[model samples]
Target: MSERRRRIGDGLAVLAGARPDVLAAAPGARQRFVALGGVLLSTGALAAVSAAFAVGMALGVWWPLAVLVGLGWGAVVVNLDRMLLVGMAHDSSLKRNLVMAVPRVGLALVLGVVVATPLTLQVFSKEIDTEIVAMQAEAADAHRVALESDSRFAGLPDLRERIATQEAVVASGGVADPGLAVVRAGVTEKQAAYDRAVTLQRELDAKAQCELDGTCGTGDAGTGEAYLQARAAADAQTAVVTAARAELDTAVAAVAAAEGRSAALAGSSLDADRAELTRLTAELDRQQAAFDVENEGSGGILLRLEALDRLGGRNMTLAAAQFMLSLLFMCVEVLPVLMKLLLNFSPPTAYDRLVQLRDSGDVELEEMAQESRRTVAQAKEELLVLAERERVDRQKEAILARRRAALAEVAARTEAARAQPEAPAAEEPAEAPRQLWDTGPIRELARSAAVRTVRSVRRRPADRTPTTV
Candidate 1:
């Protein structure tokens, strides 16, 4: 086999053969699938949005797309994040299958109803409105055409000719409108009669409605009966007017009797009517006063409650104090000394140079000062171990917190790193192979890869780089 193929085959064998059962039992497959799915989904999502935006731009309805276009990429990212979380959370055989199936089924159910119902309703409404408007328009057009075909309009030319003849007839004969004169006189007399009848009818109804119903609400039970009586009286008046329609009534005795009786009742009943009116007015005034008193009492109570709340927390003062002594004990700060002794050498939560210096056994003032400036170098192997551990922590945290929080172990290690002194810088340059670590181990492997590349390039140096600028 060629060298490249040999390397690839060896790598594959190493990956495929190592701890196969552990990977099958754990989240290895699901986690790898999640990463793969994220890449595929991201590409598809970007393509979908780009296509949608292009179509929207072509349609000239692009303004409505401002929000969807802007947020689509973020939505894809959120889904990718969700996929990773789920893959980690439910990576086992049955659990992964069950969990994934549920969301798909639920989404199908929701979308089936949500999308279909509104679309169906919209279509039905549009069809109904279109049919209704078309029917109304057709009816209107037919009605307009029938009115245009009326015989009255066809005879308008002859009518216009007679108008001049009528004008001449009026000019030749002075005051020639006997019909108008008779109509005017009849109208005036009928108007007077109508006014008198209306006045009498209103008086009867007002007396019944106001008195029997006790100012409209107190004794309103009799309102229906009184309204029936009013209707009967109106019917009787209508019958009388119908009989007299053609001026055919010549009953002078009946009319005289009605007038005489009406006058007699008005005169003798005046005192009774005045007393009834006085009684009704007094009852109305009493109800009004009672309602006003109740309303006013409730309003006064509300105002008092509002005043109490206003005074409850209207004024307050807040005070705070903090005391810190920088040098309460120069020999040994009182707090630390007491804490170290009482707590069995437990360290304080903050940075403290004095304790570190004391622990380092460099109590001399000059040496302690120099020690404060000293820094230590962490071995390259240690950093490599920590970085590998960090990657593993990140992968686990991605599962537990829905990729939301850093793992607890990662935080602890980061805090440990923060507590330690910084790494010292190098004072001299040196050539070194760089496969495994700067500290050692795989320098020979890096040197081998470098030699192979150099030899390959020298064999065909002209083809090593593209000719284009």
Candidate 2:
């Protein structure tokens, strides 16, 4: 079991290799960093794939691009997690750790949500499918209602009824028409009257002929008169028959007109309307069939998500379950970062102490280096000051040497003038007559002699020159 655990640790380390600084500062730091890093990276990989899958499902045609973006987001998340871990491990103070962790925590939370959503959806797949089916049914019902509400279909029942009424009128002949029925009755009555008038006229004419021939006892003058009367009545009947015939002709013509009007009205516009209705009904059927076909297939992941969203609001128990599940997955994704943060609370390990020691030593060495640089700079400044002073002293010495040379030349000239050896005694006594013994003149002479002696002593320290004129 120990060997197994060791192997697992080594494997994790491979996944999360250590940085050089981390390896150098702490003994066995490589494996620790690797193991922690591996957890982060592995979680990140899961997150990446899950995000790709979820986005691909939601975006449909843009799924490929969404998947790529999700992958990049996952990489960013993993990198942030790694940085957080590093900060947590390195920072010694709680306040510092919290300050450093703010951005990382925010990023981890965002990534955790991104990673958890897909897994949660998978967990509730059955419920989502059921919801999707129900949504499809509702959609189908709405489609049907929309089709039925169309003006063309809506008027179909009225159109059919109107067409049926028109057809019945045509089938029953023109008798159902009020105008045609009235015309037919008028014709029938006029024709019967004309026929009766003809019969009466024929009978009257026969009786008159019998009376004129006197072929019987009853055929007398009275009979003849009666026959005449009968003739007049027959004539009247003839006029009546003529009038009835004209009326009957007019009535027959009216009947023909009525029949023509009825026939013209029966089918002129109704057939066209019915034909249009047939076409529209066919079109509606086709549309409905197409709609049914479209709705038959299973909807995509976006539909499932929409269903889940609805479910979350409607069902509290389900919402709680989903939330808990998502939280669980989020924790899984951020486990590595959490581990590092938790470790910050624990007492420092040997490796932690070592790193701290190494850091302190580095700081001390840096301070020492800075001090050495300062000392060197100070020494250099002092050396420059001393060199400047020496140069100034040398310049003063050069000036003094030139002064001494000038004074020596003056002394040599004075000695030459004094060593001229008493050649002009008369001339000198005449010049010496001008108050040579007066106190002011004597003091001036002494001052000149003292100045000469001082110069002579400096030039040739062996001779003490006498004070002479």
Candidate 3:
């Protein structure tokens, strides 16, 4: 257990960007760094939770995938925090420290805000969900209204009414044409006239019979003038009834003909009308289905965020709570950087001094190494220059020796030519003697030139050599 605890401590110290060896030398700093590491760990865990919630709620990804992403996000946060902590060396200069801390704080601030949003949304999940439902309903209503108002579907209502009217007409064995209705009305009027005429004739006949029997009409025993008059009237009404019946029959036939024509027209167009109606109905249903789908899937991150904003706006307490919660999470994210910066502001600790000493020792050693290399390089350059100078001197010496040998050989040849000169007057000419005399000074001039060349070589400075340290 002790061993495990020790290992855990070491791991946390490393996570805090602290050297365990350095901390070992200064036990006082170990707890401080370990606590920082614990803060980092907690921050990472919070970040992971936030990421998981964001992925699940905002992106609507599968839970397992969200968890994987969360783990990756947590690792990234941990690494970024470690870098922030490690980058801040314990400097005594306040200006330098501030300069270094500003960017880091800014970065951490942005990260804190990003990490806090999802958690904040989760905190108000219930309210957000309720708001999302309301929003979806509102959107659906708006879409429905827009669809209704759209010109493409403007004929839907008319189509539906027409379909209903036509269906009723077909079911009731009625005609939809105005001419058919007029013909039927005429038939009804003619039938009423014929029935009236027939009724009159019956009443007159009854009266006549009554008169003959002396039952109720006039008390006359035999057929009198009144009875004869009633009989005549009854005969006239019979003719009227027959003519009225004939007109009624003609009107009825016209109605039947009109009905037949209407039926034929309705039959001819019914399929086409129904097809149009069905198409319009399907279009309306498709629009409704699309709206339903959109409304159902409307619970996204943006909507949730908007809901949270709305809630915050409506309730001061909620807004304050949201602000405070966000601040709390952000502070957690920024804690490591702030802690390191504050520690920098204070006097350097033992660990800082030890690290400084180690770094200074390294710098000194590196300087010594650089100096040694420069010295070695300078020495090598000087040796090469000296060797070049020696080669030049040797070459000058060889040239001098060769000049001396050539001078000596020329003198010997001159002496030999002079000793053999008695036979040369006829063969060689007087100009040869003058040329030999001119050659006498050549050796002296060559000797002087060789002396000057040797002097120039000796005087040239070895400029390629570097200065010694």
Quantify all predictions' global Cα lDDT against the true fold.
0.41, 0.71, 0.84
lDDT, candidate 3, 1-469, per-residue tens: 9999988988898999988778889989988888999989999999999999999987799999999999899899999999999999989898999999999999999999989999999999998898888888888888888887899888878877766666655654546655466778888899999999999989988888888788867888687987888789888988999999999999988877777666666666667788997887688789889889977887777888898888888999999999999999999999999999999999989999999988899899999999999999999988877777777667778877777777787678677766654444447565544554445666677768768766755665654343332
User: What TM-score would you give candidate 1 relative to the actual structure?
Assistant: 0.17
Q: Write the per-residue lDDT of candidate 1 for residues 241-335, one digit (tens) a residue.
A: 55454242333333434444444444455455445545544554455456445433332222322332233234221001000111211111122
Q: TM-score per candidate, in order? A: 0.17, 0.50, 0.74
Task: Encode model 2's per-residue lDDT on 20-40: one tens digit a residue.
Answer: 554555646666666686787
**Looking at model 2, which ten-residue stretch has the lowest summed lDDT?**
460-469
The deviation in Å at residue 196 for candidate 1 is: 36
RMSD of each: 40.0, 15.3, 5.5
Better of 1 and 2 by lDDT: 2
